[model samples]
Target: MSGHTTTFLDGLEALAASPLSPALEETTRLRLLDWLGCTLAGAASERARLGQMLASAGDGPAPVIGTGQTVAPLSAALLNGMASHVVELDDGHRYGITHAGGPLIAALLAMAHDPRMDQARFLKGIVLGYEAALRVAIACQPEAKLNGWHGSGVFGVIGAAMGTAVALGFDRVQLNAALAAACTSASGMVKAFGPGSELKPYNAGHPALNGLAAALAAEAGFPGPEDILDGPHGLIEMLRGSPVPPGALSVAPPYCIETVYLKPYASCRYAHAPVEAALRLKAEHGIAPADITAVQVETYGLAVHKHDHTEIDGPYSARLGIPYCVGAALALGETGMAAFSETALNDPETLRLMRATRVTEDPALSALVPAKRAAHVSLTLRNSSEVATQVDLPLGEPEVPLRAPDLRAKFADLARTAALSEARITALADAVLDPQTDPRTALSDL
Candidate 1:
């Protein structure tokens, strides 16, 4: 357990034998609900066509979410992982600066459907997976980003491995092997965040696929490096240029998923504050798109660093740009799923506002990173009037949680967008919220 990667294996293996905490279980259930909505909403996008095609063709045991198709656990995880983050509304951990749910939950649910796994095992696996992924990301952070690696794709492979291994009931040695093998399988391409080429979520799909393969291979008696995280060219040294911290692998009650933020805006997590600020200004001042002469967003490092695309030609770019999100929120009072379509990306007024908007990094905001993802927005009106606002935490953070009814409403909205019937939506909600019910059944209906 004192060994580098062995610490993660020991912590997860201990958690696997323990019963699920009631609070953590409820949080996981809600997260599963939110992840499902995002995945279904994204599944209908043209961006999801490649994964859908693969799902339709890769026939296996696990179900491929919306299309009524079944693929192998690995294939199902791959497709679901891609589709879940296509809309950029998945659950994110602020501390990790990464999304914990999309790839982790995608892999967990794929294995949970195997009938051998019960609700308890499935929930515990999710908890274990989230902890491993977030700790790895946090340990490798700032450096992982400085090295041009995407946290979710790089650390998420390890997270997916932990979850999949637990769900399959792997022993400590097998779990360690799975994680060690997954260490080399990590892929976090920062270039995928570019506008036209939509590989952001597709990069996530690789980890989900690779993780499942690692766990299965380890279970099949495959051998791998023992101290994958402590060796000379290990994850911590190679990725973060440091030794792995002992405290990162230590377990705390409630699990990491309880600390994650459920996204309200369908944009980068960094842009969420400005979007909230813009909406606040819109509500208080009734500012229309045409009435504004200039819009400027002063946010943290991750928000304004390279997210300066004022011209949004597609959904991926639209989701990544602070200008577009702030402009859309201020002008339209919301930056929900409706603001992400091809037509919405090409909207004349939206483009006009985007062109008028500028984003900059505020030192005060940057200092608040891994704590409160703060941002300040100042808007200049046609009459030369200025309005400014700052948000420390956006709508759906742990401090500012979405109400149960509102979360239900959000799920309904996404479900209706996918054209689900009223009855089906209700059934879906019931299955996810009720921990007694098997989540795979709810997914089957999706």
Candidate 2:
């Protein structure tokens, strides 16, 4: 085997042997549960509507979480993925700068419904999916944030394909074919962030569908190019504007799981630093919205792109708007799904505060892109007592994880919006904690 193949096989072997830690397992389960809840809550969205329409035209017995409709595995993956991410509340990987949870979870759930699959193998598949996705994400990190491609979809398909291949018992050659097919199918643009359109969810869903297609194609003896990543017109050469790094095509040990950052809030991870700083300012010294004279936010280059919203006016706008998030955090002490409601977006007081808040891209901060993601917040209070707080590391990072209580609280808060009963929530949590339990049962309850 070539060095690249050796690297990938080594990573796969390590992943196959790695036992799922209780904390990591629980975190994964919570993320899936949260995704299902959010999907159900946002089932009426345009993305969901489109997914339902597309699913109606497909075949099979895979379950669609919120709608409780049975469709083909590919269709279910697409629909559920779309539903989970339509509202932009799904879990994200800070280091990879992608939402791996949506596509990976969608594919896992679809496989979970398969009678031939076992829970242990299913859980392993999830870990492997995350490992592959994060590895590809980091490998392609250079173009991910800079070139406006949604890494979640671009790298997510590869993860889903790997998981699907494992679930289907594909050998090395078959896995390679599936990987190549996935690389060809991967695509998503960062423009969705700017507009916050239905395309955001589509980006999430497309990867699941693409992965399924790749695996299925590989199963049917479909041939794939051996040098997919290294080809002249391949992923790196065509889309990234740079040559693929030597040996980058191979995967390796430790995976990206070690560097993955879980999220504390449902909002964009890029907006978290400012939100954290605002919350600290409010809790530490009793800084109220009215007491704030002006707020300045300095962030990395990608942060500016992720949160920049000077022309947005709708709910989507508020979600991606750094000024809006910072303003809302300052005024309400938190930024949740409810905080992005139309009424909240149009609130005169909130708008005033948003206008007062200014965000600029600092070269020093921008220089830390894709590595040390950091943010600095400066607030000039009405009393002229200026307070500045800088968050070098946001909460939910691998080093600074949110506690179980924090995760439970966030899950409850989001679930409450969907009107899920306490009993149902507990049952879901139970299912997540027990890897032996069927995850589809937990999703079905949602």
Candidate 3:
């Protein structure tokens, strides 16, 4: 690969071979904890229950996050991955526009079942997995999303395969073959978000299934195009409609995982900006939802394209509707899980505000995407007074991260919702954060 034509695998190889710094390791731990909380919380959902049924065929030694069930490694990976993303509370990368942790960590947990896996190796696997997925997604860039392809579904298989290869101690050649196999399996559509959105989590689940299958196939001496990611009709070219850009996949330090945004609210990441803007206006002006005459939200193009819906059919749909999120945030002073609950969905006041909301694209803000996921909100009150607020980024982004206490509280709340004892919750949190803790023993309680 040439200077500007650095391929995704080239970047993946460099990232895999690089030394893991303390900061990278720390970020891995945080991501693990975050993924765990999301998985546990979502485990109770009907979508997760359906996933569990679909994956319950084989028996093996892999824990299904909050279900306290042991299934085959591949099944566990699929179930946990789906559960983690069902609530839309998983960590997201702005540049990649994908949720890496769902597929990557879900596969890693299943791989960690091996007695051979240690804490350092587990952490390294996560970093490499995130690097693999994020690089591929970055290479695809705006084109992939523009084509209606979901990054998590398309790139997640790569992430899961890369991380699993690390845990299995694959040589470079095997890893390349595995990635090639994964590339062939990549598929997802944005239509999953339109209606009957309960199937949305399947996009997250299938990555773990296909990725593990690819890595295992490669491990068994299966062969694939070694240059599948950069050669003729490679994954990047097919997804991006062009050759890889210069330095598109060059090795950079402080890997993508370091900057992943954790979702403080249980809705789509695209909706968070509007929700934050609405909440800010509500907090600043002390205007009740009933007093609001109209609500307008201006955001990036992708956000408007994907989330402008106001006709929410259920909680899942509500989570994707920017209008519902902003209206709910203003009406309830919050946009957490409660805002998407059945009760809130049926609330007359929330519906009234949702109907009054309009979401439009701001070209200036749209140009800043993959760098700044921003939104601006303007609320007109009963007295014809106007209040406005702009949010450059939602909370839980690295720059506007949740405080330590807040992170802990989020974990605790999610665990409790999953029916985990307070003691188990605390223990799990401590174990995940401690570098010395054994991956197997730390999760014994679960």
Best by lDDT: 3
* Model 1 Cα shift for residue 288 (angstroms): 2.7
Count of clashes, each model: 2, 0, 2
Rank candidates, lDDT, best first: 3, 1, 2
| Residue 173 alpha-carbon offset, candidate 2, angstroms | 1.6
lDDT of 1 by residue, 35-92 (tens): 8898888887743575546735556767767777777778888888888888888888
Off by over 4 Å in 1: none
The residue pairs in collision within model 2 are: none
lDDT of 3 by residue, 1-446 (tens): 33322355566666666667766666777788888888888887654465547465488888887666678888888887888888888988888988888998888888777765677677878988988888789878789999889999999999999888877778877887888889899988888777765777878888988998899899899988656777558888888888865677765766788778888988999999888888878877778888999999999999988688878899888998998888788777667778877889988888889999999999999998877899999999889989898999899888998765777788888887778888988998888877677555665446
Q: Cα deviation of 238 in candidate 1 (Å)?
A: 1.2
State the displacement of the C-alpha of residue 107, model 2, in Å, after optimal TM-score superposition: 1.7
- Candidate 3 segments whose C-alpha is farther than 4 A from its true place: 1-14, 17-19, 51-55
TM-score of each: 0.96, 0.91, 0.95
For model 1, what is the error of residue 424's alpha carbon versus the real structure, in angstroms, after optimal superposition? 0.4
TM-score of 1: 0.96
